[model samples]
Target chain A: MSPLFTSAHEGTLAVSAGIGLLLLAASGWVSVLHRRKPGPGTRELVLRLRAWWVICALFLGAVLAGGRVGVLLFAFISYLAFKEYVSLIPFRRVDRRALFWAYLAIPVQYAFIWTGWYGMFTIFIPVYMFLIVPMRMVSLQETKGFLATVGMIHWGLMITVFCLGHAAWLFVQPLSGFPVAGAGGVVLFLVGLTEANDIAQFLWGKSLGRRKLLPGVSPGKTWAGLCGGVLTTAVLAGLLAPLLTPLPVRVAVPIGAGIGLFGFMGDVTLSALKRDLGVKDCGGILPGHGGILDRIDSLMFTAPLFLHFLRFYYA
Target chain B: MKALGQILRSLLFLAVAKPFVALVLGVDLRGRERLPKKGPALLVANHNSHLDTLVLMTLFSVRQLPGLRPVAAGDYFLRNRLLRWFSLRLVGVIPITRNHAVSGGHPLTPCLEALDRGEMLILFPEGSRGEPEARAPFKRGVAHLAKSRQEVRVVPVCLGGTGLALPRGEALFVPRVCRLVIGEAFTWTGDTTGFMSELEDRFAALEAEIAPPPFPSHPNMT
Candidate 1:
């Protein structure tokens, strides 16, 4: 295995590029099909495919950059997610003052990741911010809606900053037997499988699904979709884990199933949020994807869990 | 020389101040189509933060920035030399005395003159910053100006979230999303009392238009 590109890692990149090419071809085909028989859903599908190309390119670019750049890329994602979350929620006048502290927490949390201070990075938001955010609000002496306000801001920080920050921390993790060159591949494997599960579920549900999984929360998810997604993700994880990480194939299968299950939970959680907020999307920042929050809803669940799974087993 | 200064000021506003405020505050301008492309108009808004004026200034098109003059309080803006320079040269603020006894002149004189010159004048009819998420009653000055100059269009702009951004007494500006809801331009010839009530209603409606819905309850509770 060469230091720069092991045969296995090179194969992974080649497969990723192959997937990108296939998506491009599919987009071109859809463009032509839409020109002939245009419908709103078809038009949206074309847009989604085009957006996929851009997202893939960006993800691949950041993965290839490696080291601190990869960490900063994830940090940027967390910032956008936090912004989207803040914009959606109704904040009190006093809560607005506390939000300054909440927004400041993002960079400080990421700074922990960049510097590789695992102890502080793990506890900063859940422990320090948990105590300090309310203290800052208390000093203002506005107690109206105090508990709810603190809970909301703290929840936003946890999901958007702390949870997503774990993905960036993956780059710095010292997997006992894994080569450093394979770190990007490991990050890619988790991201790719998680996202692939989402797509597979949607496709399977549309084709063969019945009996809604959580009809009230998310009308689209179904039992058939969940089963298909979990099975497919487990198989994919088993295949890719050997190439990407030091985990044995048996360990990879359950991790894949865990990501699929948790990813669904995340999606449903956000769906419940949008349902309550009475908004279809968090914001219109991403065309066809709704918003940054909408796109990364599943990652909010998968990233942290995968990080811990790796940490407990490999670190 | 005066024209040159005006051009430089407009350039600075467009290049520096506009983007700075927009980026920092996340300013969103809605109902912009209601504003006239080129006409004499009076813009009355609710003031709660220092960002209100800057948000309003950045809303105009480059061609309209030179023609728009923000009516700032003379007591607050004219006391300091640097602020006076900023209000006059950079923002094209027309300082009006809130206390008639202090100036011994009509407070509406400069505003009327600017309107008569076919320039757009922006006014905060509340006169001063009030409690966050609340509005003080509109002063009769805006109604009187609207009544007197029936030819000039009166547009009510309701700014949401600026109060939270800088609020009344806070010196440090917090970056948050602020929205400007520009109401429809209408000619008002009604009595001052009736006009002020109507303007207040318009502000209330615009505020409701952009306000976020209440937070969602927990799933278990539901």
Candidate 2:
């Protein structure tokens, strides 16, 4: 094996390319179907497939570029997520100074990942930020809405910067027992399955979904979709485990289930956020997909959980 | 020379000010369509920070910005040579004396002249920066000008978050999301006092619309 590409890494890349080709074929089929039938959902399906092509190209390109580029890519994702999150939420003029400090944490957190400093990367945002943000707000001497303002800023940092930083750490941090060369493959596996879980749930829900899973928060999710997604993702995870990570097939089953279930929770969490804020989408950065936050809400939960799971068993 | 200056001013506004506000403050403009596309109109807004004029200037279409003149304080903006040149040439600011009683000329004369020439004029009714929560009572000059030039539509605008960006006595600007709420244009139809009160009410309603909910009292902080 080359220094950059292990057999597992190569296999994951091949699977990614295969999926991309299948998506292209699916898009072509949908375009022809739309031309013949001209249905309402056909246009949206074609648009989604087109977006998937772009997303796949970017993801594979970053993964193939090696660890430094992969980590940088996730850092950029964290920045966009933070920008969208901050812009959507209501914050006062008094909170601006504190918000500046919150924005500064992005580069510093990514720096920790680049240097491979695990301890500082974990605590820099969650702990030190928790203390410094409130203290900085105190200097303004405006007590009105101080607590609420501070809490919102801190929450934004934790979810967008801190949790996403964990995904970046996965690229650079070394596990004792696992092959270091397969880090890119592990990232590909996690992102691939997590996104696949989202698509599968949506498809199953549309076809077989009758009973509402949580109608008030996320009306589209259904019990049939949940079960179908879990089964499909678990099977895929078990299949891809050997080619992506060192985890055994039996262990991969539960890990895949964890990713699917938690990914559902993250989706609903953001749904509740949008519902409370009275916004349909966070922002309009992506076409077809609502915003960066809308697309990556599931990863926020899955990344941190998967990172810890791998560390506990494999590391 | 005048044409060259106008071109430079337009370039400065387009290339520098617009992007600066968009990137730094994340300004969200609402009811922009309410602005008249082609007409002489009086725009009155609450003053909270130095950013108010720049923000208002950015909101106008490039074609309209040339005809738009903002009424500025004679004391602050015209105090020195460089400040006076920048105010007049760059933003097309018309100086109004703070103490019209002591000053020789009528404070509303330049504003009226601008409107007479079919130009759009922006006026800060409060006349100077005030605390965000409470606006200083509007001086009678805006109402007087509106009544005299009844043909010019008087539009009330309510601005929020500029004070937080560059509050009084603070040199550095803190980036905050600002909102500019452009209100409906109404014709003047009453005494100066009545018009002043109505305008003040319009500002109050807008402030209420955008104000953040009050913070709950904490045990630690009185």
Candidate 3:
């Protein structure tokens, strides 16, 4: 590893270049729209692009800084996402202490990632928090809405902390035998592909989508879009894997396709969540993106799946 | 030396308060442009946590912080010498007497004086922090304070989720998103009742400004 980048490697630079190309393309596309009759759509597109710039800068900077910084960033994100999820649900006064413990699990989960305790990182939230949160709630001995509340808290912890923690855990993995691109590359590969899959689906859906994927859940998603998106993402993943990962072309393409499929699942799942809650956005912190959860919901599912997949086959 | 202390106090306050508010809790501001640019202004909000004052302070520029005085209960904020010093010196709080004014002085007398000095005062009409994320009926404190000071622009702020972040009883902060919706400034129209009702209506509207839109609770709607 170079002293300048510290934890960054070939894969890190590869991911950065990919993001730069994306920005260049977006900026160029937006600039050409001025010659045509511009409207509210144009303004929104510009705002969306600007937000992407900020998101990219912050993310890549964290990755480049080293694994520790990346861990902290993901920890903060899990904290924010959990905050968004729990705030939306019905929580009583009795749940305060339990809420504290649930929140404490975020740091503890990330601490495992920081210390490279893969065993605990994977099961702590799913197994331990699953039992412990309900126990704390039971200690309060509040039975009314007890089961519902306990189930909801544990589920949220799994999604926001456990699932997202996989991405941070990627940063901590030993990259000595993996590839020259290092751990940063693996983290970037997952993020870049997941994000690209989202964009590809949106574009494909808009252009060729004649049928709704889930008419009740997401009115926008279409079958045509999903197929097109997964295909594109699979191809992109195959091309980038050689530069970024230790995976063979056969493994990489399937993982890419899996990511695309799972990414869509996460998006619609959040859509269903918002629908059930009867709210549009989780939070309005991001101008165009909604909340941190909204921006990274796809990653919430994809991160855990990819991390475990790599563990089974390669790690 | 006084000016030096003011600068030092603001530096310390900003150093400690800004990050606590910004980093730990997410703040969503609405109608922020309506916040008064200059003082002799009144910032009335619904209180739930100690963070109510801190969250409001960060909305203003650093230079204006010296003159921003949060109107807090004298008995609550000034019971001890240490608290008294911290509140008075660091927070720049103008302690409002909560007890009966047996001395025949108006309860809002000190607040009136602060406004006279062109300071921006934050008043929680609820008088005290109560339950988390629950809006208590705003007392007539704001109307009472603004009654004599007709020139001061009364900016109504609806602060939500501060309680969820650091509620009254809890010492530890569980990070949660906080919302502050600043409403259009209004004035006392010589009728305390009318002003109170108007402020009440304004808060209702501001709370709705930050509140999530109503949707069917059951999943059947989709």
**Candidate whose lDDT is highest:** 3
The total number of steric clashes, by the backbone 3 Å criterion, in model 3 comes to 1
**Model 1: clashing residue pairs?**
none
Query: lDDT at A121 for candidate 1?
Result: 98
Which model is ahead, 1 or 2, in terms of lDDT? 1
Q: CA lDDT of each candidate? A: 0.81, 0.81, 0.83
Candidate 3 per-residue C-alpha lDDT over B1-222 given as tens digits, one digit per residue, 9 for 90 to 100: 778879888787678777776767778777878989989999989998998988999888788888899988888899999999889888888887878755367788898899999989999889889887778888887887778889789988999878867888778777677878888888887898888888888888888777754545522112
Q: Give the alpha carbon lDDT tens digit for every residue of A1-315 in model 3.
A: 122235567667766977889798988899688447588888778777888888888898877675577788889888889988877765656677888999999888888888888789778888899999989988888777777778788989989998898898887776547642377778888999999999999999999999887999999999999999999999999999887788889999999999999999999999999988877888776777887889998999899889887887866
Task: Give the C-alpha miss distance for residue A309 in model 2, angstroms.
Answer: 6.3
Between which residue pairs do clashes occur in model 3? A11-A181
| Distance from true location, Cα of A295 in model 3, Å | 0.5
- Rank candidates, lDDT, best first: 3, 1, 2
**For residues A18-79, could you state the per-residue lDDT of candidate 2 as single tens digits?**
87788878988999998988876887777767777777787787766656777778887887
Candidate 1's error at B31, in angstroms?
3.8
Candidate with the greatest TM-score versus the true structure: 3
Regions of model 2 farther than 4 Å from truth: A1-99, A114-118, A134-152, A167-221, A228-259, A271-296, A306-315, B1-8, B61-64, B190-194, B208-222
The chain A TM-scores for the candidates, taken one by one, are 0.94, 0.93, 0.93
Query: Over the stretch B126-194, how does candidate 2's per-residue lDDT look in tens digits?
Result: 877977535888888888888998878988888877786688766766565576788888878678778
